[model samples]
Target chain A: MKSFVVARDLLREAASRRWFLALGLGITLMLVVMGLSLRMDVVDGALAATRLFGKSMNTQIRAADVALRPAFVASSYLIFYGGLLFGVVACADFGPSLLAPGRIEHLLSLPVRRFELVVGTFLGVLALALLGALYGAGGLVLIFGVKTGVFSGRLIVSALLASVTFSAIYGAMLTVAIAARSAALSAASGGALVLLGIVAGERERIAEFFDSGISRTIFRGLTLFLPRVSSLARSAGEIAGSEPVDPAALTSMLLGLVVFGLAALSLGIHLFERKDF
Target chain B: MRRVAWLVAFAALLGLSAFLMSRGDKPKKPERVLKAEFPRHPRDWEEERNRKRRTLPPAAPRPGEDEGIQRKRDPLLVALPVEKGKSSVVFEVAALKESPIGQIWLDCMLEEQAENKRRGRGRDDFKERFGIDLLQDVERIAMSSSKVAVLSVAQGAGRFDKSGWPKRTFGEKGAIWEDTEGRSVFATWGDELVLAGVDVKEIEAAIARLESKSPPQAPPIPDWSAYGDIYGVLSPEELADMLPEEQGEIAARIRAAIDRVDLHVDTSEDVAIVADVNGSNMDDVTDLAKSMGAALSLARAGAEDQGDDRLRELLDYATIKPRDGRFTVDVALPLEVLKQMGPCRKRDAAPSSSQ
Candidate 1:
């Protein structure tokens, strides 16, 4: 209950920021532009023609769902990557602001436990990420659905996956801010983790560069614990395309990301408990 | 003590999550099956030669020719005349004619010919002059370093009228026909084989080789490698020579680093072209493979930027895989892409007889 109060306080703080307003305006402008310029000619569930800004895009007739798959995939990837980048930038200061000297003292004086504060901040950032993803991905899905009459639920799922991915990234950022009390450091660490996660996704292929010896083994060991961020994004795009995906593998990956985020949040709480402000 | 315990528990949880994440295996790289091997001399050369001799009937010796030689029935492979260090390409025309893309190509060719005829450029009508339908008569066409041999169907050879050709010099097994300018030579052996080359002597040598009058040279491409609708081997020099002048630097680099490239094309459904690039040094081959892959990615990006969706779609099927001192580059055009991009689209729109 105390964590919920802290979370509400964080949300209230976020609602007053210019960053939230800017994100909302950006998505609205994009939706308006897309709705005005994109045109499709559908005949009997087949796409006969497509025009963007009055320029012919495709003349070959194909099933509407098949023709629009690339658009969905591109949107899913944009939401996945663009959302993570935006979250990293927007939520970077949240952790440092929460851990500021006066703010930390006031929060500690409340009934909220130190661990509750960390968990609340994490949940607050997660909610913000989910909201951003839904605004971007959902608006695009609605536009495409209204334009082509082919509604897909996969893009919504992709938006949720992007939010979960941001949670994992934000957990690390929170830990960094708790330890260093610097927004720059927090943002830098988050960016670095995102890059490392991408590399880890292609670890097996990159491992081929090293000769079969200690160097290769060390490379593999270092990347073993990193989250597969790019793989998750790719799977999201595949789902958006209605491609076959292994359900068991996707479940394991989702579970891994959640556990990893919790573990990072726990580490942040441990740091917060040890620090004397 | 509590802080230390918390750190330990975090580490344990990190390890557990990592284990769970690793369970979702990465898609394994497709295994490359090297169907073609580097061309080498057959070790059982003498034994195979003797066995071939024992199976053939003896031919009557000409005044200048050696005895105990025989005219063997041509099985298309025996007439290739490919020599050591030379390049060769064989097209299985009959098999290609049955494929969807092949039919489109033939229709396009026939349409062009008909258009040319309508324009009064009436010289290239093989059906009118020789009574041979290119779509149905030719079985396979093999082109080597200096010779081109077309193996006709059983009934195709009888359709040709030698009287219509230019001046000819009659030989014991075949005749070498000379063009009006005397710059080119065409030879016909038995009934089903027709060969063309720059020099009459080279054409005669090929006929002699087919007749077993001369010792057989090593096959430039092994018989087993010739499995697809089109198969060939390009020597390093040949590869360099085939490149355009704009790609001079690339041609030079290929000549220096690459040894040979074996090519095979399957046209059953999707048109797939696989080139096995072999090099002497493993690092050079790996670098070459990486360069090719990078080039493809750049091209794809350029196509996307230019909004050339057809080019982008075609490039999406290209892939390069390097394994053990060699690499394979594969480009496949799916049937749907072919139907969209092929000449058949215009043909389908119009009332056409070939359909």
Candidate 2:
């Protein structure tokens, strides 16, 4: 609807702020480098906690002789950390523009309805995030293919889904920043949401919530309704060989990206339409 | 934007190269290796250096060294590993019924054992009721009676260590302990353990067969006097055969492995070890002994790789057939013989103690 106009404005705003795009891209690049270089094996450090698992009764097994199971198991330990880092940065990058001074007035003056503006901005960021993901992940695949001689379409697809997940959170937070009075508060709010997720991620209660089918469904639904935070890092993990990506989860994430992107776009437009700024 | 895309593609290639290069860490191999290991060496070197290293390690460098240019062969080098009471056993779990593909083997075994029991033909009688062809191998341990006794030892299934640490029990203290099965002893007298389960009727037939076999009558410790030419002898050439370059390589490898250990020296007291198979048949028993040796060798190599020259056991399987599995085909050495090899050597009491 009118949300498409808002999505374009946000993209144009981010494009104009070239440094913001560079910073976000740079941070994600760092995450990719760190993740790609991480050695996942029986070797010591970084992999220590990973090694203390999956018992084999075969005593004759030598550490040097052990084979890694195929899948995203290699980067399992760092997947969450990867998601958390990039999600925070992505959210911060998207939020500032939504709350930038004079932006609401400029958005309102446009001939496009508020809903179309919402849809447009939402689609615009989603497209950009998808493009960024392909760059980051295509590099990962090239290196991983040479090292292991293995290419997994699942990895690329899952990572793409995960990138969208991160974009969802950024989209939602953009809406929040738009609704807020100050850019500083908007960015802080965006950042705080990611931080809170990280801090609360490992709590048993949260773990139980993730473990429960109902909780997963409800939380997933909420993410779709608002904005997502966990998908892109998970997708990155899939590429980095950390977690298996379920088709159902990816579908949910992709669908959530579209839904939340629309919602955030609409919510931002609604807030901007009434604001005098 | 297209340039950005091209740059991203280039970055992808760079990242790919980085990952590929990092995985290529293959260490160089070494040559002419010499690894000496004692059963137990102290981790506390401050205490060991201050105190007398006990057990006069077999390879100790003596103070009053006699480096005679006159070549005399070391008798121990020529001496063959004697049958210090050799024994053997073989345990093969051949599928009685046709095993199905894609099915779990262990589960099939338990199920098969159950089905036979339902038919009142099970291992409850261990031999007769179950016509499973398990065999026995026996040698003349007793001169008077043709009867052969068999023993199998296994670790008791108890929560010994809940931390999931690999706790090895064999050869620890060289003290023989009863398995939870209470069938075999860990180490009865200065050697490894062998286990066998057999049909007694089959064993009787083995005993009759073994009765016709004459026992090799040899001295408890064969006299070394006749072979005195090699006594107390070390040719300079033999000692020099252990070149500095060879030792350096070994030492370097040892040092690399030392990160996993707390050892301070590269001393090992090499001793004669005999490994025997505990089987129902003589061949079975011998094969079991050979396997015991293979398993021990593997363990020794692993411990050596870890840079600890202290957990070697010069053990051989005694050709002593615990039971006659070769006779019955009802049984052989238990398939679980791998468990009997007791993985880690016991702690060292004296650094110089002759192994």
Model 1 spans with C-alpha error above 4 angstroms:
B1-5, B28-355
- The TM-score between candidate 2 and the true structure equals 0.40
Per-residue lDDT of model 1, residues A159-265, tens digit only: 89999989998999999999999999999999999999998877888899999999999988988888889889988998988776788888888888888898898
What is the C-alpha lDDT profile of model 2 across B305-327, one tens digit per residue?
A: 77653342221111111223211
lDDT of 1 by residue, B1-355 (tens): 8777768768988998888888874653443322322222223652353245233344355667676454443345565666655778878787788887888777676776777788765435655655555566667777887555545444445334543666454555566676667576766776676777777777777676667644555456655566577877888788888877865766776788898888888777778888888999888876666656555655666687899987876776666656778888777776666775555666665656455
- In candidate 2, stretches whose alpha carbon ends up further than 4 angstroms from where it belongs are A1-110, A196-258, B1-121, B125-355
What's model 1's lDDT at B68? Answer: 49
All candidates' chain B TM-scores are: 0.68, 0.17
State the TM-score of candidate 1 restricted to chain B: 0.68
User: Lowest summed lDDT over 10 consecutive residues: which window, candidate 1 chain A?
Assistant: A58-67
